[model samples]
Target: MTDVPRAVDRLDDLVSLDTGEIDRTIFSDQEIFDLEMKNIFGRAWLFLCHDTQIPKRGDFFEAPMGSDNVLVVRQRDGSIRAFLNTCSHRGNAVCRAEEGNVRNFMCTYHGWTFGLDGELVGVPGKSIFYKDKLDLSKHPLRKVAQLDTYRGFVFATFDETAPPLEDYLGATGRLGLDMIAERGDMEAVPGVQKFTVHTNWKFTVDNVFDYYHPQITHMSAFSVGLIPAPPDDFVEGGAKSDTGANLEVPFLPTDLHNFVVVGEYGHAISGPDQESLEVTAGTEPFAWRHKPEVEARLGRHGGRVAGHPHIFPSTWVTTNAQLSLRVPRSPDVTEIWWFSFRDRNSSADEQAASLDSQIHFFGPAGMLEQEDGENWAQSTLQTKGLKSREIPQLLKMGLGTSEVVKEDGLAFMDAPINEHAQLWTYHAWREWLRNPSWEELRERTIPRDRY
Candidate 1:
């Protein structure tokens, strides 16, 4: 393990909240990544396998917890548990497969066997070879500190002191999950779409709130009609700073009516205001949310905000009925996992239609991510260069220009397509990297005048 910096007080030097300029080294620094794995990843409640993924007893799913992998298993009592995959005798993995139903896990290296509940059950030639000196009870795989489910979604954390799953989710995080949970009996698609994108995980995370990039980064998406753009001289957010061009695209309208919600403890939601979108595009993108019950559950903020919602760390809920986890392999490598969802209550045809839209937009074969991956890869490369890294990355858009409006136990600001969410995430990222107490983290991440 790399030596972590003790002087977290100096975090402001790396992440400038005042100037909205972040030092580029935070993206690719080995030391910084080490700190992140220890503080951010270790403490935050990370998304694990969905409850639907391991429905049957003895079924399991291998999930990433930072650089470590854990086996999420369903026990005989119809409960879920997660444990480290490594064997106690040797560090070799007991299960080599990514996921499946198994009665027991026998390590290939030494044939030490573990039960479905991750208890050490057998060791080959224990009596003959070691006279049963080793205590099998002591050798059971190490379990996570906490495991819980909300709306059939499983999440675990290594911090015993961490808040309960629901409290940790806060208003922002719940709404993110509600985007799918409210869809009337949802389940994870049979197989997760897993792929690698050569970018720092932070890029993928902050990009979720980045509504500005779509029209430009994914212009091809609009050109090819992957994203339905409105017709003619529609303008949004006044003007694009780079080209000084208004939203004058021939195909799509410019008014996304973007909304943003920043929550305590680093959770945030940002994207096109779906209601405004339905009006401008002459289509109802989020018709499902109109139900009175769903609206009551979503509250005012959730009901009106239609866009991508990102929980702290790396869980992203996109508008196209998908939940994505950007698992960090290292500073420069991230594994993207997509869990497509459908309203199980809907007819087969409706589910199929949802799946078709979901697959084409952002999955492994999705046209949009292919473009995003290229941009994120190159953007990461620029940060690795010695001289190039000295230049600060700017998150100045709408920086200090908007006031946070408080409502329904949440804080947010409505702006004309700005980087407030991205900058807010980084601000919270720095606070998390400082390894503050959970209370302090929640306090630090509260919405402010500027990100």
Candidate 2:
């Protein structure tokens, strides 16, 4: 087996956009994972909790930022603040609960209490043990460098120099959120469904843009009528013909067009075009995108992006009115968190139906996720093998064939089912691991005339 090159010396060899091949070591290497935590997760703006999750003052939700856990708390004045969950004194988590309305966080370890704004307010033995030498104000929980929200979705970054939330999101990212926000007065559902997947987080992320897998990986879904089967003509044209002796599964039709939007900082939206989807489904599933106001906001191209939009590192915006965070725990372990949303004004029955769909689609209990988890787990496992890790993973479908059209602040393409977005993501990933300046990173990731 070939030995892997040092990360710093061979960043370009890790992922080659020109050849659409990625090194497998990136998925399982401990040193590379550590670098990612510092260069990507540490510096990038990470999604925390939705603003609606902690609406009331003193409400707090524990969220993971890289390896550290943080408490996203609502201030007394209705502002939001987030700080490390660890107590300043003893490094013990001050708040134990995942979420709740807390008066103040008092460390059970040493009785060091902190205010909602992350101010160190009380120390139990300050006067006796320290003889009043310890200052409460000197040791507040370490706060995040920057925190902001976009359309009620909260994000924070440890890098103080990271761009503002809007600037970071850019047009493609904003359009992804807008797809959900413009649906109505949307708010997060009460509970966030979270589960562990024994896979590298990158697999879960790139899978968002994979249109090729559903037809094969989700054949069981089609067999059960969970997803609409392709038209008879499409099946005849592409499916393997089996007499009564064998199982016949139709493939994703080749003629169907996919809309791919790739943006700065690894953000991308890739899947079937809304028009192509209507052609297959024989009904309009995305009528909301056609609404005058929503169309005006989404623009011509954005309105047709009936696909998964992924922000750099880990946020995934789904068309089913949900956001998923693929949190990287280690090289081989990832935590998937699903935050389902609903319009505040929707009817009870509509809300119930939405919740049911959300529950049955991609969370812990969801069949699709269960199927996907197994594949990702096995894929991650193979990356650890001596021979397998030496192999380059191929992503060559529709690679050099697509022309990128720049319009309305989006660099996109309408092509057949392809890996353009996936390739684009890896390209961006390589640049990010380089830890360039924000301007330099943007320059490196800027979409070219052809993807």
Candidate 3:
């Protein structure tokens, strides 16, 4: 394995929190990407398969953790464990299938078998060729340093020194998951809609907190009524087309308030308030937030966050009962996995409707995702150009203007549609790339009084 690059020496030059500008090269640099796989993905608690995906003994689901793949297995003892998928003997994959129930995994390259608990169980020529000298206990598939679940979502980390899962999540991250968990008896839908986008993973991640691009990037969805359109009076911003003429652009209503919550380790929630969304999309879509019990749990501020919640690095929790994992395959390629959720107790019609909305809104065939993917691909493509890459990407929408308000163990901001959350994410990203201690990282990512 390659050593983690000393990228922190130029972190400030790469991402300037003071100016809200970021070096484009960070998106395309191979060295930087390698550093991320080691320093960020290797350390942070990454979401794996949900508990619902593997409930029975011997059931397993494959998930990506940086450049490595892991098998999350339900053990015979009614517990879960995860380990690297590679065979210990020859480094070949022990399991070929993506997910299934099996008594044991036997490597195809060499019939070295492993039990559901990831213990080496059998070796074809052990007695004859090896003379029974090989130690199976010491040669079991390498296990993850830590594994835990929150609300049903399984997460794992390769860094044993990493904080406990809950501390890692903090208030903002917990609220993000709570947004989905509080809905009802939620469970992962049958299939995970996955596809690849030729874009830097960071582009997909930062876009979660972006509310400014929708009116323009997803105009097709709005035109087709897939996404609710801005009211007639809401037309305020304009963008210059290739012809240099100004094209009318619809913007969210000026008075619409956006709620932003930033927490340690780069977790954030940002977008229009639930009241603002209801004003435009109607309250029926967000009726769950209004429930007395749910509202009490989400609290006043969290109850209003009708937007995307991002757990630093890659996990994104969408308001529409879906969680997306932006798996970085390369500097310019990312595999997008959509895990849709539904209330198991709901009527079949309601469950079908939920899946339909999840599919149409943000998956391989989703209209909004298709539009966003184009922009992200193009943005990443520009970073490779000698001249274009020199230009700094801007996130100056609401820089240094919003005051963070602390309430009920949460630090948040209420403002018009802005890029505070995106900027916050980049700031946290810079700190994370430095590979500081957990205590240092927490201090660095703590929400500032102002942005």
Candidate 4:
């Protein structure tokens, strides 16, 4: 781990946190939330729409970064660039459409226009309005500090000093995106499903790692066969209601395993091993990259990672052809966007079927997200209470017991479904809130044998 002054002083309080347990205050504190906007969202390489969404010049899409929004455009030179959507002239939004093809953006208020590359291209009466003295170049849209793509997923950052996209992503983060990229000839499914949840953004992020919640939160999905449900006699810790009994219930199948890849700059990936066929029940639906030699490539270690993978701050890559972005709006509100994709090799019917399942599982009408959102919303409300803010959250499941196996940039733990990944994220979050130098941030969060 890197030595970081900004975060080190708060280490004890931060690490003391138990997985699945948290002080309600974190969800509603204005100061903490504001710091998160700067330390986490400001510096992270947040996912924008896929390159396919803006394949032609003049095509653009609007994406959120914390409370701010950016316009990602396809340039005439066959490249992509992004800039803040706010106008350089008077802070008015320069573009209002969610996505469309346009030669230039004309601000509704003052008619200021900007080119695809965010260059100021036209003003209604440039010479007459400003005596030809105003420099359009100087007032061009404020370009994002960095923009990059991996396997077609575009991303941008606001911090000029942030590390290059690849370095910041690390192997863990790369693997997360690669999971979707490895699927055959993938592309975004066209429309992005947007919905708002009355909860803190972090709830959506941490929930991705929560295998423990599905049975309870998404019982509807389980009952309807959207997800496989355990038999009546099955139990995790035990059949008893006590924590010790529940701890002994044996929730996960003995063979099911999890791969947790903790990386530099607070990026991490947590999921079931992909190579394992048990997850697919022998369906083998996805055409994973290097399938001809994936077993050889991943070896015995990586052959089984088949669970959800999350990029720090706001991106989630699921085993199915889907990606989701959790955009923070305010301390108690979050906007989630879903990008569903399909294997280009599949027939039209298969693609449609796949999309149907995706919609039923995660979108606005999805069974799973609704249940999860309720708890999140309620949790956020609890945080607003003064007394609730002082109580500590807990993440003790599978703690102090499981030995983490570290290999090939991934941190492995054989423990049954637990809160290790969620706990690790909060620890990383605290590090970011301290706002250390990039070098220190990286140093403090490098991969380790155990975390």
Candidate 5:
């Protein structure tokens, strides 16, 4: 086997857990991006299409795995499997469409075809083609090392030795996913929304746990009522000013506490605790979780999730029942795919409202993400400058002062507005970039005694 380059040695300098400092080069360096594709993206259990997406026989969705794409198909046996979209013969894509129902994937190139289970079953002019030297079975698409589902959400990984999906996710990660699953008999909204954003995938991942940005970056949301106004008014005198609209609403007091859960393998859940969020944002979005039945269904930390939860590498689950995949394309480019979910049993109006919220929240035309993309893009651009990179990126707020607590089988901290979650994620990011053994990686990322 030709050896892979030594990629972990420089990681120590790139991120400093002790000081909560991260070198900007990791976002702009070609070498670091290549290594990430090999280590992080190559081994992690990445989210594929949800089971509801390809429920019928012969259904398939072309999903991205790092630089390559895979065909995620539902076999006649009702089992789901994923395989490289490339034809083994000449490495040409076997399926051209993003998703659809097909009896088999036929490579438009040389006409090699694969079954739903990824078996090589057909080849044009087989007998006349080089005396049929190619063993038909040997030319099958490359299958993922592991593919599994949790509550209908499917995921696949390229590392055979990696831990089982459940253990890898741990309670913290699953809790993030559970919030979406327990929202009734849910199914992904038809048609995924995809668009390219000029930014490092890490920026998107880290932002999932960011409660600090909404007040500033999403000001329009508050002003336009996308995020409902709080019950109490703190605007200079609890009174609307001169012209009309409540323009001077008070921001979450600088002291608003945020809760967090940092798990092994770099996953995290962070945002305001249940009460704080209720106090700031409207209660309608979260009232369901407080129902006795819903709380029991959620179980422990899952029930208490008023925060944004992020699965390591790049899968983000928001309280709104939407999932976003931040796919890394290059050091300075990332493609985002959005999957929205709604309850099947909900009234038509309810589902329609969910879809409308989903469409206007974070996809290509979403007002929120459009603004966020600009910041991420500019952030990535600055990293490419020599002098710009030297200015250390800081994530030191609430670093050592916050106390972590254990509850519902999770280790987490709840504290006033601060950078604990972002810093924790970067600390975990550094550990992943080290390319340590799974045991060591898990050991390194276990939540600290304090933030």
Candidate 6:
């Protein structure tokens, strides 16, 4: 017999992350991915479309929850609800359209129909076909375990045991959202930009926080001037001649500092000082940190966090103002969806310009993402081999050098961009795979501010 551990114990191996390295099997193993779907995606609060997308009664948007899908609908009373799209009678999807306004849904299989609230209201044959034996009132649509919205962004969870949405987001995740929300009267653009990539989902997640690859991986972007050339005075901290000699790259000014925030449930944020964006960018059109209120609300961490802020398991929020969801379709195939938002008060032209920036930065056609995806695809493929999978992936940037500090339910690192947040995320991942009670999970993952 194979000496396989229980699913819980196996998760430990999958999440075996230390300061300097992580196991390769986590990216290529089917068994480990299956457990992740159950213990992680199944229980955690997954981001859905914003409430504004379905403002009127009967409007709905379709969202994926792990392998399953759900319909996010707005009710007549203005509240929103989400339920599985599958029909209760025969398991066929009751709704087929990606999104639309509908008073009711009818399954094409048996003509089983349901009301806006997902209550069964019609059966094609009824008394004629079933002699009225069907208990219509007994089964309603399978509602999600919980659904909630904060700052106009909707999220849903599948486990009834999961913590409340706000509690789960904690401070770190909230800061990430706050960076976007404080932008203005912001709402999700009417439609999402969806695309697929043949790479492990973990690659997409890790890349969100990776600050080291830009100069080389995106050298083409720099060459083509998609991202502006560095200023004459820009200098990288301890950057080598090979890494820095290429151009007068506008280095993060000497005053720019990296601030990392680690929150409960594996969520975290990292960035350069909030004011750095304003002071360094000067009059650059792409600069987004000039607003005093945003800098103040973001506080010290916001000022220093130029790196991406991540809500663990799948959501990534960027300093340039974009949100990405990394959907795991399989062990080696993942879907990346981009949502671009702009202040409704901004002029239409301004909105278009903001969206243009988002598209160029990380969408399917994004210059930087194209390069990153290539590496991720090759990495996953190589890891499938016995010898290759045995080799460890490194995360050693600023490893033992990280000095963690704690405050207001967040653990932070004061040093220049370090891997502390990434390490913290893995630690929480191991605790979550064990499937502890919500209270225990919170206790185990809560930050102590120091490592």
- Highest-scoring model, lDDT: 3
Ranking by lDDT: 3, 2, 1, 5, 6, 4
For model 6, the superposed segments whose C-alpha errors exceed 4 Å read: 1-7, 10-19, 231-256, 275-280, 283-292, 448-451
lDDT of 4 by residue, 168-239 (tens): 887778877877776668888989999999999988988888776765676677667888756444446436
Model 2, 34-128: lDDT tens per residue?
Answer: 99999998999999998999999999999989888889999999989999999888799998899999899999997889888888989887888
The 10-residue segment of model 3 with minimum total lDDT is 246-255
Kindly list the per-residue Cα lDDT of model 3 for residues 155-194, writing each as its tens digit. 9999999999999998899999998999999899988889
Please state the error at residue 288 of candidate 6 in Å: 6.2
* Candidates' C-alpha lDDT: 0.85, 0.89, 0.91, 0.77, 0.84, 0.79
TM-score of each: 0.93, 0.96, 0.96, 0.90, 0.93, 0.91
Which pairs of residues collide in model 3?
400-451
- TM-score of candidate 3 to 2 decimals: 0.96
lDDT of 3 at 9: 75
Model 3 Cα shift for residue 366 (angstroms) = 0.1
Kindly list the per-residue Cα lDDT of model 5 for residues 327-348, writing each as its tens digit.
9999889999999999999999
Q: What is the Cα-based TM-score of model 2?
A: 0.96
Candidate 6's TM-score: 0.91
The candidate 2 region of ten consecutive residues with least summed lDDT is 236-245
lDDT of 1 by residue, 199-278 (tens): 99999987888766776778788878877665455544444557777654333334457788988888989877776667
What C-alpha RMSD separates each model from the true structure? 3.3, 2.2, 2.8, 4.4, 4.4, 3.2
Model 6 per-residue lDDT tens digits across residues 180-269:
888889888867888888888988877776656665677688788777545555565444476545443424434345677888888987
- Candidate 5 stretches greater than 4 Å from native: 1-7, 229-252
Count backbone clashes in candidate 5. 1
